[model samples]
Target: MNITFQKNAVTLLGTPLKEGEKMPDFTVCDNSLQEVKGGDLSGVRIFAVVPSLDTGVCDLEIKRFNEKASQYPDVKLYAVSLDLPFAQARWCGANGVNAVTTLSDYRERDFGRVTGTLIQELSLLTRAIFLVDDDNVVRYVEYVPEITDHPDYDTLEQKLNQVIRAQ
Candidate 1:
């Protein structure tokens, strides 16, 4: 998908993953520099992809998800960025973003490339949201057309509620 980065048209590295697609095998570094394999994660997951935590919009997106995630205690919320692991840890600690686990794609951009969130021009992940179920199938996806815009939080909530209702 093509996203406007500060109004400049830039396309993603690959076709974005759509709902119903299985999670691709990928690895990302946690805040502690631990390797996390995407396939190993089992349960409802909400992945919030951002460019960097230092940016105002990325900061707010993760913070808002971290704050609201408490209501859905069973769901795993993750914030992925291209920043280094130490920086992610520092940002999470400073912002008190405990509810969301931060992951870094600095080394290989494994997760970003597999998920098609990597921006071709900037080599950064664009703003997006992916909701994956226990079986590892993507149930909801929101690839924000613009990097500066926020994803539809209410629609995401409704999708989560739908998952709850299904159970």
Candidate 2:
């Protein structure tokens, strides 16, 4: 898909995910450098994919999610990126972000390829958010048309509430 990054457009590599589809399983390194399989994560998960943690917007985005993470202790929130595990760890430590988990896809880029957030030219993941239920079924997906734009927070909160109410 064609997604813009501050007016510059780029194409994503794989097919985009849709709601109700099974979440694709992939391997990524955690902040501790431990390999984790997406399928191994149980319960509701919110995956926030970003290009790089060094960027201002991406940094703020992750921090924002981290701030909100405590509201839903049962849910797993992940900040996915192509940054090295060491960098992810450093960033988390420097920012005092302890709630949301950070995963690095630098080695295989599996998370980016599976989620169709891989930006071909940039070799970075495009900005996107996905909410997957306990059954591994995707409950919501937002592929931000503009890579620099933030996902709809209001809708995300509302949808999360709806899911919580249904459970």
Candidate 3:
């Protein structure tokens, strides 16, 4: 059987996201199953945090960022993952991840296709981070080449600081 997958206009998986690109509006489900859309973050600096909560690296990434989220009071952090809402809620509950808002894109294919994070032959999202300003412009993006590796937190922190300072 031949299968064709949808491709994004931009390939972000192995490349750094350019600054000034407007982020595509997307709707994802929150832990409570309520729809969370990009419009809800119009005036907030958003961190599009992607991970696979079931994996060790992803768990550590979420935990680390959740801890750092407290320091960035002006920034809104959203932990985006492919895990089901129930699993995400359970994981956050057990890990005490109250600082960052966890969102799941499992129900929709927008995130995976629009962001180019969906693995070609797998049901997993690539480890990546996207920093969007209040105007919804993508300021910084990092796509870890190796799915098993963690993102560079220091670099992300620095960029986030820049965004905060600019605001």
Candidate 4:
């Protein structure tokens, strides 16, 4: 699906992940620059995709998730972005963000291309969220229609609650 950035139409590369489909395989870098693959993560996971950590919208998204994460200890929160691992680490440290782990898609657009969150024009990820259950099936997917807008946190929280209850 096409989305807008700063109110201008922009293309998102690859097919967006759909609910009930098996989560696609992809790799992202951690703060330490180690490769993290989707297949390696188990249990309920939330991929909080974003463009850059430095941006206000992305910063708020990650901070919100980090704060919300304490309420759902069982769910693993991942903030995926195109920012460098070092930058992510710095942001986390400066902001006291520990509950949510940050993953960088810089080395390769592996996660970006597969999740279809990669913005073709900017080569950055579009804001989106995905809930993957323990079985690796996608339970929820949300792609912000506007790049600058915040996600529907209410709906996302509701879905997460349902997933936790089932777990």
Which predicted model would earn the best lDDT? 4
* Per-residue C-alpha lDDT of model 4 across residues 14-98, encoded as one tens digit per residue: 8899999999999889999898988999999999999999999999989999999879998999999999999999999999999
Query: Can you give the TM-score per candidate against the true fold?
Result: 0.97, 0.97, 0.85, 0.98
Please list the residue runs of candidate 4 whose C-alpha ends up more than 4 Å from where it truly belongs after superposition.
Answer: none
Pairs clashing within candidate 2: none
lDDT of 1 by residue, 77-103 (tens): 999999999999999899988999998
**Mind giving the per-residue lDDT tens digits that candidate 3 earns over 74-148?**
777788878889999999999999987888889875576676676556566667788898778998877776666
Where is model 3 more than 4 Å wrong at Cα? 1-17, 44-51
lDDT of 2 by residue, 57-160 (tens): 89999999999988999998999999999999999999999998999999898988888999999999999999988888988899998988888888888888
Q: What is the C-alpha local distance difference test score of each model?
A: 0.90, 0.90, 0.73, 0.93
lDDT of 3: 0.73
Which scores greater on TM-score, model 2 or model 4? 4
Indicate whether candidate 1 or candidate 4 has the larger lDDT: 4
Candidate 4 contains a number of clashing pairs equal to 0
